[model samples]
Target: MARTLVIDAHPDATSLCAALVDRYAAGAREAGAEVEVIVLRDLAFDVHLRRGLRADQPLEPDLVRAQGALIAADHVVVVAPVWWGSVPALLKGFLDRTLERGWAYRYRSNGLPQGLLAGRSARVIVTTDSPGWWLRGLMGDSAVRQLTRSTLRFCGLKPVRATRIGVVHGSTPERRESWLRKVSDLGRSDARRTPDAGKAMPAPREIASDAAV
Candidate 1:
């Protein structure tokens, strides 16, 4: 069976991002995949990588467990809200503090870094207030690059796929439902695609009042 881990990067438990993760997990479970969720806000850990790679910032127990889940999972799904044209600081901090050298990557004989977490696949779901296409066309999709190319890919996760759920602020309840259904379907399709290698989850529909984008 596929082992999938969903990481919620939003600070608010009641956020739309959280709802999306729950729906995605529900879809994955219905498809027969084993799913686990990590709510960053609920965990007790510091977000700062104070000394960068040179500092031996010890991993907290929760972080250790998180790393184990990440290493063992066949697929990783990251859900977060886009803030200031990028991911929230909570998510950024989690990445900075968790995906460290030696475990995530290490310099090889040729002086180039080699990714350690190979054979895993990842999906990044980003919620934004702006239209996705417009954001991509205007701002060059920095969030996607940061999550896919700069982070997951750099750490050896293959074929990182991203989904942008947006215009949340002005969207109607009907539109939100449609987006939720779409994401749920994606989860089902992904679970069925590789049975052993699961696909990433998509963004969910949020309550209009609690919507971010």
Candidate 2:
């Protein structure tokens, strides 16, 4: 069975992000994948790296466990709200501190970075207060770059999918329900695809069974 790691960066479990998180997790779990959650609010770790990784901030025990889940899961699901046109500081800080340079990526023979977290797949579920597509164009997709192109993909995670839930500030109950269904469907699709999600992964890549976590 596929293992999924879900990271929820929201401060409140009753928030819209959490609702989507719950729905997606249910759908994914119902579709036959094992799921775990890394709720950042409940973790005991410094959000800021202090002076960056050169100082080598130690991962808190909870964050370490979170990293372990990240290492073991065949698929990752990240949920958060849009703050300042990007993911909230809670989630970004988790990425900043937990996704250390040497742990997730390393320089190769050609001075190019090779991602070690290959064969893993990921999806980001973002909720925003603006209308759909407003942030992507206005903010120039910095969030997408950080989550999809830069971080997750940089570590060799393939088949990444991202869905944005927008207009949340004034969204009606029906709109929210519709968005919930979409995220749930995404979870199901991802769960269904996990058996072959790593078909395109590089050979000899580390899988959940091979991880020390």
The residue-level lDDT of candidate 1 at 8 comes to 91
Best candidate, TM-score: 1
lDDT for 127 in candidate 2 is 82
C-alpha lDDT score of every prediction, in listed order: 0.82, 0.81
Highest lDDT against the true fold, candidate: 1
TM-score of candidate 2 on Cα atoms, chains taken together: 0.88
Lowest summed lDDT over 10 consecutive residues: which window, candidate 2? 204-213
Model 1: per-residue Cα lDDT over 1-213, one tens digit each: 988889999999878889889888889889988899999998777898988878787776677778878877888899998787799888888999788887888889999878888888888989889886777998888888899999999999986889888888988888888878877876776677644754453222222221221
Clashing pairs in 2: none
The C-alpha RMSD of each candidate to the native structure, in angstroms, is 8.7, 5.1
